[model samples]
Target: MFVSRKSIWGHTGKVMALALTLALNGACGDDDDDEGGGDNKPGDSVKVTGKVTYDFVPAVYSTATRAGTLAFSQVTKKPVRGAVIQVRQGNTILSNATTDDQGNYEITYKVPSSGSLTIVALAKTTTPSIQVEDNTDGDAVWGVGTSLPSNAKTRDMHAGHGWTGGAYNAEQRFAAPFAILDSMYTAARAFMNVRPVQFPELKVNWSPNNVPGAGEKDDGNIGTSHFSPSDNEIYILGKDGVDTDEFDSHVIVHEWGHYFESNLSRSDSPGGPHGAGDVLDPRLSFGEGYGNALAAIILPESMYVDTVWSQRTGALAAFGFDAETAPSPSDDPEPGVFSESSVMRILYDLYDSGSNESAYDNVSFGLGTFYDVLTGPQKATDALTTLGSFVNGLKAQSGVNTSAVHALLAHYRVGAVTSDFGDGDTSLRAIYTPVASVPYNTNVTLTGGVEANKRQQNQYFVFTGTGRTMNISVSNLSEDVDVEVYRRGTVVAAGYLSGTSPESVTFSSQANTQYVLVVTGYKEADGVYGASVSITSP
Candidate 1:
């Protein structure tokens, strides 16, 4: 009930009150000079925070990358400053920085050619501030690039001279639309019902100075700069940092596609990369093809822009691939660079072909569908299950215990090859016997018209460690055929006979090894069929 007045207290009383509040926030030290620590040593704990920015003009068609500074306040829920922040990409490391009292900061970092990257900031009172558990924020900071700008978090930005663009040209392009190379993950989570922690570190970075003829100051190691090795960080080669033409069409999408493929493969099988290929042969091609396809998928009505290169559609179009009527690139009489699918080229064909009419069914167009021959579900609803089917098939072929799939996934995944194939032992996927012996006088039928006895698919091989020479032949069949060698489902090799006239193949094999041969008919049937292999000790 007592009334309070606004009148000031005594000078001494007021001074005393001011000192108390200063000490509480550590804004002002005690009367003792020692309290300052000379402004060098760590001061009273201050809550630190920060926000990261990446910009690429999404509305435009050029390859200009720009960035902005996002202070802690902008982040809405800022992190505790005064602590260390680390960013990463896959297993690569990028940077470590500390936030100031205002809870804002920025640090330089390296960015990889292409792929999804993540950045992380950890706050802890102790020396080892960060550990396995990192920042939960996805759009925190990118050592390179990880997302595209949207109306929600994007702005027409200018960082410096020659860096004119918004947040959609470079890495920012993926930010708003798909979470920067996160299409598979989004689809996986919604459709597969799994929320496995797939990403670990973070990578963040960007550059706007890169233009066709305008030179840039920084071009990373091997003309390829990258940072954020940990799974938590991400990086983007600034538009000014690399050639927009090649980088955007060939490099960026290609590399990111690898990550998506790796992740999907991981979820599908216990084995990672190695298993993925064996289990999902089409997936590998499809995965790589998908990357190339993204350019078309995103633009839908545009072509790649490489200031200096030939302004033309992808190779798939020039070659005129026909999925329904023409033979696959595999069937090309004299295939050169046609062996591998240029994702860009393939995707362009997809767009030109239109959505309702997936040109994939035609072998002539080099357009094909993994789902059509996959014998499983499509990517939208059952990615995990669909991938598992691929893994199970590969595992069954590898002749290894299915339980060991996880261990294999870990093993090869750590190496250059990610052993995460859903398939078992890939050895059975195909066999390559350099040397073997069979009576060439009578051909083994590859057209599939003759039974095992009628064609003699099984043959004999005598091996010498030094590598032996051998040849094969098939009766009357005119078309060249492919054959896979196996050991209890382990693939020894998978290939076609380079020569056709005599219907024969020459090869060398490992010494003291017993090999089994399985013949596959050519894609098309030539009717007359017969074939056999022969191995001669050197």
Candidate 2:
């Protein structure tokens, strides 16, 4: 895997030539207020307060769909009943029914598109589904490959949950996500020397309420945040992808892998570009490949298919981790669980080699050059274990989690990239003054140097306590390194980006613990430049 950072494109010609066959169920949604040409500008959100009708179609493309309907009498909490309704799709109408005094209503929405579709119950007044997603959500659940469940609430889905980020430490208790921060920080230390990634803060989500057929993100569930120029909520999907317990818990850690690398700007690099002869970014690919592989390495017993197969009889003994090892169950999903072609096999091979390529399976192979940059943690990233820690230090030092993986690779731990990786943490990165101290309520601005001519980027810091609202000046700066601060990761305040250099970015802490400062990168024609971090919080 390490030999002069070989040219990745040389093998670009082999589009489908995967070293392993475990890549599974290869992997959208919309809101239409109104379709128009010069159109009636539909309100950002229309209050469809009237009775809305719908039907549930059996398949995405099936014509013979079932029809049903519910009528709503009131929209507010206290209920009203006795109303009629009908399901409609374009010119087609499915049914007309009445509500039975209890205000309970129902109607199926025809499969409008291949993505997640919402079915709203519109009436004079009603409690419509906030947003209902189709069955095709989690790969494992969607692939149940069976009839639809009669009701949504009663069903259970499984997903990985035991994960604790770059640090393979501790048991996860979903109720309090912040509990994992210490272990995650430790992992960041170990990760700094090797891979390049940023650790924002540690958070967890036990159940990702709704996601199926694969589009669901394990990025992080809703618990806490560090910074944001965008969204700051971490999302974690539950066991079976349904956000529930009771199913095999294999998916928990795999998604945590996503959250691990997804802390900054971009979550992954490009896959080999199609026809256009473009090369995919490896930064993006490594997380998925590595996360899945990492999950397998840490999975607890009770979860393995072999465990189940073996208990039933020696028959399942044949099925193990790969085709060469595992015993396949007839009930197992496609691509037999124990084959050399399994995800288990590819992940094992990649880790066994200690970042060596001949051993790099399908996913990691795609992450090429990105593998080189931060062989360890530095000033920017959160520290982690061994290789994991080195990568953390590199991120914390470089301080621009927003840059593309390739751009971060350019740093060599001399810098770190800050990115929210769309964890919805828009303020994921920010710049700070590294000041020795600051006055409690004084509005102080700080200045720091970013590499010359590097792409524009920002960093965030927070100051919260009694009644201290910090004012920031971004109008003038030594350079255009993006910087700001947040309260609960919300963009309610500002700091360095305003242009006035002062003692420090000022803010008061509500809890008076430690406020976070983040720095991120932006895409410029050449690429991204590194940003630094500093702060003034008391």
Candidate 3:
């Protein structure tokens, strides 16, 4: 997994293999002139207005296909929404304004020089969104971008260049993509000691009130933000209010963490809504929890913050809450396979040398150790990748003592995690239904999806398969049930349906191998389902 430093640069091809998935199109309308012009007298300021759009080609990354292709014919003029813009002269700062709905900005600033003042639009400081008076002209959200110093010289004095480069760390509000790039830099900088793997130009798409796709309708009001591994694109919400995530450095880095995992390692996250405290699917627990930990690792700050801002009128330009608090693993009385908070705490503990307060966090494994396991045995294992799997892999390393790591996991009530599948946990007495194991050629009756076991309705069992064709079947007596068989964590076969008919699958399995069967509801009840297994040899 640890490629030679020189060969690591070639890893970008695998990272950018996917095409962009979303296609965004914006039609810029004619702008209305402001009535009150600036007072052009001596020492008086002039009103300046400009438009902001990305002057680059848009590429597509597809999640379904895990491929990326250039959308050469597609329009590239993407209007940045809710970005703060400012006007400055020399060392003196003037007025600031947020882009309006149409990516246009107007700021009134006093003249700085005596003869001619060269006013420059600095990205991200303080700003205000546009105003709508009657409804004569169409409304559009303003796009923000920071002009680099090299690009700053291209600004037109007379006509005023519509765009320029001026990216600064503090000016993330003006250039949201800069924050994402900065997050990548922070992550890459840490790995620079070993010469980190190279990555392609990650395509990022952002706008107000839009999902990943061009015309995909958002059912929920909460804006969607994600990084498509197949597409190699990080989609962000530039919308106003609680939906914005660009300025939230933690949120940006968290999404980028997924990109890193999918490229540099492997992530088996089933992909769903996973909160820090929620009892989640094991896959979701590790995926979301790992991301949360990476954000803190990259920033190394006391707290992780996710912010939401207002595009319209308000005293507060943006408001945010912390993503991480002090390590409180004991707060969650019932920590299980679903707790991302526990996963994050364990990961942070493994890598952190500074957090010496907690006995659980006494080990200082460092990020290199974390990276080694993630890219090595954790990835090679066929077992269900979870917190337990990560711990198991970490212990297998040469330098680390397995007992010390197990002590840390036990301190957090993670249980005696022996393997990746969490084989020894007995906490299911109050949570999940009792698991019933059936030998080959045996039948077992299982009930799932009952209201009492909503979160833990899925039933799991183990079957020993000799070197032969193994047939596993599930028949719903009165309810609909589905079945999935796993050799370790790899799904060998799965069936899902909505009827009472039996769903079955047969596949050739290895000799004396342990196979896991998972039975759950399809769309209806999984009540009183009968499951049977048969093995046929030549």
Mind giving the per-residue lDDT tens digits that candidate 3 earns over 1-538? 1111122122222111100001001112221232233335545556656665432222233323333322224524444334455543333345566655455666566654343223322222122211111000111112222221211222211111112232112212233443343345556556544545564444344444443233432321223677665555456665444354554566777887887777677775656555545666566777887888887777775355553333364212332222234333343454655677677767777767754356655576867788888888777665556776787788887788666677667766777666655655554222223233333454555555433222344555656667777677777566666777777556788887767778878888887777666666533454555555343333
| CA displacement after TM-score superposition, residue 493 of candidate 3 (Å) | 2.5
- Compare the candidates by TM-score and give the number of the best one: 3
lDDT of 2 by residue, 1-538 (tens): 1112122223221111110110121110011222222311222211112221111111011112211111112112222233233333322333334334343444443333322212212121111111111111221110010011112211111111232432211222111121122122223333443544445532232333322223323333322211111233223323221223112222344444444444532231222211111111122223333444454444422122211112343221112222112332421232211111222333343233234333212222212223333232311322111122223333343332324322322221212223322111111122232323433222233322322211123333333343444333333333343443443223334443322343134454454433434333323334433333433232
Q: Stretches of candidate 1 above 4 Å error?
A: 1-41, 59-242, 245-254, 266-285, 292-538
Model 1 vs. true fold: TM: 0.31
Worst 10 residues of 2 by lDDT: 139-148
Clashes of 1: 132
In candidate 3, position 208 carries an lDDT of 41
Model 1: lowest-lDDT 10 consecutive positions: 149-158
Cα RMSD for candidates in order: 20.0, 23.6, 15.2
lDDT of each: 0.30, 0.27, 0.50
> How much lDDT does candidate 2 score?
0.27
How many pairs in model 3 have backbone atoms within 3 A of each other, for residues 3 or more apart or on separate chains, i.e. clashes? 28
| Best candidate, lDDT | 3
